[model samples]
Target chain A: SQTIHQWPATLVQPVGSPLSLECTVEGTSNPNLYWYRQAAGRGLQLLFYSVGIGQISSEVPQNLSASRPQDRQFILSSKKLLLSDSGFYLCAWNGGTANTEAFFGQGTRLTVV
Target chain B: AQSVSQHNHHVILSEAASLELGCNYSYGGTVNLFWYVQYPGQHLQLLLKYFSGDPLVKGIKGFEAEFIKSKFSFNLRKPSVQWSDTAEYFCAVSSSGNTPLVFGKGTRLSVIA
Candidate 1:
């Protein structure tokens, strides 16, 4: 069974501080990974997605960036966080095939004070 | 730009009441549709999806949705919702295979006991 893990279930950081969130998938190889953020009372917003290691596509323009260091590891980082960055961050993956169902992680809630 | 729209922003319903949430997408191409739910203090979970073949698709927790191509809509329905159904619902769409998903603003459903 494939499972996704995200670290730091919740975080409280001051504005302008650096931010880092990690996600890794188990029991799968060469899967497409994604990063999403959900604002309060809003839906999921796609931030970045990677087809493989070192290859990333950003959906929305922001201070966030993503990296795939290993086959099943993904990292979301920001040099300086803003209040608008406070939200629920989710990690997801798909089989990279047509119309394949995407699975989601438990998500990390970040609050920028 | 591709986008998803959920008609309802917030809804309050009693237990055993019928549930219907409207979703529409703006993309003139083959698309994959999805419905996701987020409980209080929980991550987003897949409730149902529609790729092709059948217009009416069933999902977990006794939820279903019908895709109307002519209307560019995929509305979610549940005959009788329980109090546990109180959560936020999101509608999403993907235009191409292996592409990123675009989500709506989401509908907040509060089912009373």
Candidate 2:
């Protein structure tokens, strides 16, 4: 079975600090990877999605950016964090084909002080 | 922009009671629908999905949902729910196969034993 792993599970960073969150999927190749953010008691908001290595689509413009360095490895990064960046970040993946059900990893709770 | 709307923000029910959560989407093109469940402190899991064919779809854990094209609604239902059913449920829709999913604000269900 395919599974996604994300870390660190929780993070606290001061404003203006660099941020890096990684997500990796095992048992699947060439999967579609996505990054979503959910503010406290809010819905999931799409941030970025990658169809293949070095290909990324940004849904919203903000302080964060996403990159697909490998077929199964996706990373979300920021040169500087903002207080508004505090939220729950979730990593998800699906089969290469479209309309397939997506699988999610344990989300990372990020709090920017 | 296309969006998904979940009517209830929070729902409380006793064990063995019927469950029905409303989900509506605003899009006219070909779309795929899905319902996801997340237990406390766990990752999101796919409860059910609707792509093509049957309008009524059954998912794991005795959960089901029906797609009504005219109403643009996909409502989740369970004949009898248990205390173990306490979780946050999300409804998501993707208009085009290649696009990212648009999620509803989500419904928090608390089933008391």
Which 10-residue span in candidate 1 chain A carries the lowest summed lDDT? A94-103
Per-residue accuracy of model 1 over B60-92 as CA lDDT, tens digit each: 999999999999999999999999999999998
Candidate 2, residues B1-113: lDDT per residue as tens digits? 67999999999999999999999999999899999998988778899999999999999999999999999999999999999999999999986656777789899999998
Task: Give Cα distance to truth, residue B21, candidate 2, Å.
Answer: 0.5
Worst 10 residues of 2 chain B by lDDT: B94-103
Residue B31's lDDT within candidate 2 is 91
- Runs of candidate 1 exceeding 4 Å displacement: none
User: In order, what DockQ does each candidate have?
Assistant: 0.64, 0.68
**Alpha-carbon error at B27 in model 1, in Å?**
1.3
- Kindly give the stretch of ten consecutive residues in candidate 1 chain B with the minimal lDDT sum: B94-103
**Best by the DockQ measure:** 2
Regions more than 4 Å wrong, model 2? none
